[model samples]
Target: MRPAFVAALALCLAALPAQAQQRFKSSAGDLVVETVAEGLQNPWGLAFLPDGRMLVTERAGRLRLVSSDGKLSAAIANTPNVTGRGQGGLLDVALDPDFAGNRLIYLSFAEPRAGGNGTSVARGKLNQADTALEQVAVIFRQMPTINSNMHFGSRLVFDRTGALFVTTGDRYGQRDEAQNPANHIGKVIRIRPDGSVPADNPNKPGWQPEIWSIGHRNVQGAALHPQSGQLWTAEHGARGGDEINTPKAGLNYGWPVITYGVDYSGLKIGEGTAKAGMEQPLFYWDPSIAPSGAAFYTGERWPGWKNSLFVGGLAGQMLVRLSTQGEAVTGEERLLDGLGERIRDVRQGPDGYLYLLSDDAKGRVLRVRPAP
Candidate 1:
């Protein structure tokens, strides 16, 4: 091609969106990332409707719908009042397993309370025709609401047994409460669809009956392992030492007592990363990626990526792909680092492709597929 023609082509390519031209290669194959929708304000969670539309939660306490064709809808009405404080707000969304018939959806948010704010879960039916929630009810609320805004560990996932698992944080100022089973701070709680505690829960006498696990800092990412059916979570550390744990019934995850990280001021944290009875992480990162949403890839669209675990990194600004062998992570790959956007959530679409939400004032939903 002539030099003048080549110069014009370069300018055209430069004008295209970053995702349009940026490509990455994974163990599966060459991949391309493209923005599906934009203009979202610090979007956090995403769930799909039966008809292929998406329900997304904004950190500022708005829930909106995005059609399959990428059209964004106005905020759905009847959402509860949220604190929207630091690191808190409307966080995660999940549809009922029987959503088609029940029209039920669950939301996890930092709820405004009398003393202050706390993580709470609510369920409501989607009145599609009216664009509002019907029968909205707060199903569960974290105990002893505190004034702090940071560390509202809120993520929602449903197991095959129909129990809902909700993650809560240490409320920043209440890290010590993570070890206190009586309170809901910094814990994972499993409850029934109607907000009742399960009979088989491994509950301590004085502890909250709904708690499944404890000793977590701020768990924001959670999903079920596709094959093992175990619950896995990713939590943020103080300054460094981000961790991924497979939380189990009545297990202690060792947050303030045993951490791989230190205080933000570079002080030691909890007895130097190990203790006699505390559970260790399946994987961890030093220098902290600040991981958020997670999903296990079981789709056929990327054959080689099957069974992989995908985690979004906020501070690291990338998509983390962990190749798994059974219950253990065998390898890791970081995708979309060149895009330089804080990835907030990752999910596998029903169409078998990977989807992500960017965290920013002008956040966007992104789709990933095999390059042509």
Candidate 2:
């Protein structure tokens, strides 16, 4: 997902429950949460198979498949080794637009390099015989990889045009790289499914040329709005400035240069929150929700939530629902606060239920629906 904007880990006092503890009220009132699967460790991302099964990724670099009957399969072993320190590990997973016919999938992970780790995306065909992946090959890689252990910003989403989008972190010390088109850090890159640059992108003289927009800090959550066919992303702010942005082609998002968040030590970031050349966030959270995963609701089970945006919060330990009217965030609601666990990802399943993954050693996948 977006670069991690999380607080340092504190001593594990009392373990939080793996499931939500109370009935949450939305506009419809009284939300019900049920356990779909359990006994997962740091479940990171999830994508639904065409047959209504789910493919899930774990940060420790294991991939697992869940059948429609909620049976968890053995870990798929072909996943490459990951430098699973801090935020570096296996991250987001996605299915090809034509996965039903193609049986292809994509994954993002922290790749170990000479100096340190960099993010990489690979594609493969899942062979159902042994439930393992085959013909896996890296399609994209970040350049000039750094030595830091944080801010990988590895999330994947496909647009309506069949192009793929990938997010990169600024490597903690290189926040300014987000503003430099010549660098891949802190940027959302657009590419063809086979990892080639699209010729129509805003070309820079000596830049990587795949960058769609620059000046992003760390983006973990991305989804395509069903109605407008537009892209939306959520990222962690420094301390208090988490943001939700509507990304546009050739635009600047103004990360370190303009931010609503102060440093963790309570110091100012840039000159101010606004800059002449930058696009504004659709909505920003002042106290920082530590946004991790997001999905636009298009499930038939919740018809009233058809156009809403669902986001998972790590630090805030909640699910956020935003009512959107043509990119304007008109209303906000919180769900599953009583869960007491850090939410890592949110996805709408093929069966029309909303699924969530918790970010803990004993993390579990949960389903939410209207109470019977």
RMSD of each: 7.4, 7.7
Steric clashes per prediction: 1, 5
Candidate 2 Cα RMSD (Å) = 7.7
Residue clash pairs of candidate 1: 169-186
How far residue 99's Cα lies from its native spot in candidate 2, in Å, is: 1.2
**Model 2 stretches astray by more than 4 angstroms:** 1-22
**1-372, model 2: which lDDT tens digit per residue?**
112211111111011122443467778767777766777889999987654567889998889987645668999868877888889889999989998678889999988989887888988888867378898988888877888889998789998888999988888888988888887899998988899998877777666788899999999999999999888999889998899998888899999999999999999998799989998899999999999999999866678788899999999999999999987998898888778889999998655567899899987888877776
Predicted model with the maximum lDDT = 1
TM-score of each: 0.93, 0.93
Query: Model 2 compared with the native: what TM-score?
Result: 0.93
Model 1, span 1-372: residue lDDT tens:
465754554353223344444688766778888877888999999997755678999999899998656768999999988998779899999999899889999999999988898899999999967389999999999988899879988899999899999999998889998999999999999999989998878887778999999999999999999988899898998898898899999889998999998898898977887888899888998889999999999977788888889999999998999888877888889887687889899998766778899999999988887888
